[model samples]
Target: MAAFNFTPSDTSLFILMGIPGLEAAHIWISIPFFTFYIISLLGNFTVVFVVGKEQSLHKPMYLLICMLALTDIGMSTSIVPKALFIFWFNLKGITVNGCLAQMFFLYAIAIMHSAILVTMAFDRYVAICSPLRYTTILTNARIAKLGLVGLTRAVFFILPEPLFLSRLPFCANQIIPHTYCDHIVVAKMSCGDITVSRLYGLVIAVIVIGFDLTLIGLSYGLIIRAVLRISSKKANLKALKTCTAHICVMLTAYTPILFSILTHRFGQGITPHIHIILANLCFIVPPMLNPIIYGVKTKELRDKVGKCRRSSLAATDFKPA
Candidate 1:
């Protein structure tokens, strides 16, 4: 086996021109992006803080919501700031190592987000479908253990992406066209044959995403069945409403992922651009929208945020000095 000749490139390409055939969007794209980024950060941070501070919110569902918010914050942190810089300053160049680091955090948090969603689905299932057993099944200690387990699963599953990217030899063209380091774009730049890399990416996707989706679907299916069997129409409607936000979040997150994979694998030529846009949307849009969806649908989280805000204002007004 020939020693993998890994030559790190010093040439910095404009981020907009990093992708093979895609043109950069106008700088005005940053305006809406900046607004969305601010909202995502505030919303996710509020969820984490409120869940941590309130004893009443320290149950399985809220714990999972906290984890989800943390993942959302991570996802936003990994991509948006750098993207904004690239748009505003045209500072798009990244070293090979830097690119790998970005990909690691980006994909790792993404996997974490998926795992958190799966955990949340299980939480919902227990609360609704097995109410009698909910407390026994999801005790605080158990929730803590499950959270650790989910975090470990996410980290272990995504380790291969960064490891694979680090080993690949980069070509003389070092510019990544997208705003940040995207795994597909980075893999496409490898000078070596990437069949194994692509296959591994697909396999990881299938294992993490496929398993998560199946579990979510099964949980929801059981919940729906249980709701239908309930004698009270009011109970059934309320139960179904509880799931609406989660279902929407799952759809937004999964649809773009499936679209990106299908287009990348099967679609030819012009499809890659569409895939790139959709892939970007998958990361950007979901983090931006998830908090809003949760807040609008879950009165508990909304009320908690409102109470926290009021408490903060009251505290500020009571200065003794």
Candidate 2:
């Protein structure tokens, strides 16, 4: 197959290096990536399935969890399969349009995750601060609308990324150093000045991640105020405890992401392989851990999961051995 030559008239094919400087460990590294991908899919899907089936879990909080699960699945699926193919089979020729599509889905789902976290924070806020009006305020119709708004916000903001990226001429080398097509990596490959692309990317990042963090922080602030006002120490502790899982999930989702962004853009001293590893972790950790956190923290979800396990075991035992 002919590799894409730098020509003004044709689409460029980008080759993704799974991990540039650590090619020797590609196979070993792929093992953990594969494991995380599988766990992310199974864990998140179980959360969605269980939350969907259990009538008691038909509340705003669980509904948001379902949305988060779907986002996690989408985010991981967009990047990991291609990465695994590059790692396992050394097949890394991705067309320009294909790369744009992957970038679009990856960032869109990431923004959606941030939006879902904000909504989850709001849910906790209402449940804690205004318990009586919680159901009335966050009714099924309202939750669905919020979900739609979040999706629209993500899609609207992320749509321009691929559009702008597609227009840029890639006259330079078509090799991408990372496992997947990141916006920064792809944008910087263009022969022309990429100030517009870079600025737009930063603008979108701020609008999505920064805005969501602000809202989430505000929501938690109010929740804290409400918790502090409670007369009984046990009630206050209980209220604060409900937020622990969400806080952990939030940290897992954003901390690595922020670190990855900072290191990629400014950490000139950092090694390329380390930056790539952190980038991969930004996608992997939250999805793999979210369902486990919720399952362990929420008794209702834990009970339902246990029931599901027992039923499956019983069915297996009843079958012909």
Candidate 3:
């Protein structure tokens, strides 16, 4: 833990501060984070449970939703537990290997979420614009292949970080300013020149988030045009309605991410805690809100959720005290 530490030893560690300048309020801030975790877990789990139990819910669209729910869970699980442990247990020091592991999962899962949203947009595009070809185009086998491709792509982009990071010389201080491990944040802590790391991260943001957003925008544009081409007003409305929840989820998922990235490189006037909070929100908000948005917008999911709830109630052993 000395200046210009050239290599990580068996005991080299990086300390994660829950939130700098607000140490006294760490526990207080953690309350809402904890709430988000619970709601996100239960809400996403319910989505999966309802979809699994109801045979009618077994479709390409619903299965994709289930994939999305699991991705949300992975995104949250990557950071929340360690963050909470830092807040509640004061266990801030993480080993080099541990920090690398966190960084890998955090980045990979977040990028995976973006990839899945893009897939969902494509699914809707096929279903709405080319209804007759939807099944043939997005078959069960094809979807599985797409899932594998997404998983592999995410890992490929993220695997380089820790590899190069392990070789970078660290400054005297090994403390990270936020709740979780971040690629750029950790890279900045290196005493060595980090030009390569910065550019690599920029390339990733461009290809993953920027490119995915472009695809999503184009898909929706075509979807809108296809809907307008429908002569029946009822059919047009139905098709558009099917996309509303997806649009909301996409906004929730990507808006904070874009804001954080833009602010990171250019927003010099922004406060550190504000940037960190927004970065955390990129993971927290969507997981907790995706199911709620979908359930509210889609009557089918809403009804199935209700039915599952009623069934659970009926099966409960309630008795007079």
lDDT of 3 at 270: 83
lDDT of each residue in 49-93, candidate 1, tens digit only: 888999999988888778787888888788778777766665555
The superposed Cα distance between candidate 2 and the true structure at residue 221, in angstroms, equals: 0.8
lDDT of 3 by residue, 1-321 (tens): 222232344238888887898889889988999999999999999999998999998878888888899999999999998888877878787877889999898888888888888889999999998889988999867877888888999999998888888889887677889998888889988889888887987898788877898999999999989988889999988889899999999889888887887898799998898888888888998999998998899799899999988888987956668
Judged by TM-score relative to the true structure, which candidate is superior, 2 or 3? Answer: 2
**RMSD in angstroms, all models?**
4.6, 2.2, 3.4
Candidate 2 lDDT over residue span 68-151, tens digit each: 999999989988998888878788778899999999999988988898899999999999998999889999779889999989
Cα error of candidate 1 at position 97, Å = 1.0
Model 1: how far is 154 from its true place, Å? 1.9
- CA displacement after TM-score superposition, residue 313 of candidate 2 (Å): 1.4
Arranged by TM-score with the best first, the candidates are 2, 3, 1
Choose the strongest candidate by TM-score: 2
- Pick out the ten consecutive residues of candidate 1 with the lowest summed lDDT: 1-10
* Candidate 3 wrongly placed segments (more than 4 Å): 1-11, 317-321
Task: Provide the TM-score for each candidate, comma-separated.
Answer: 0.89, 0.95, 0.93
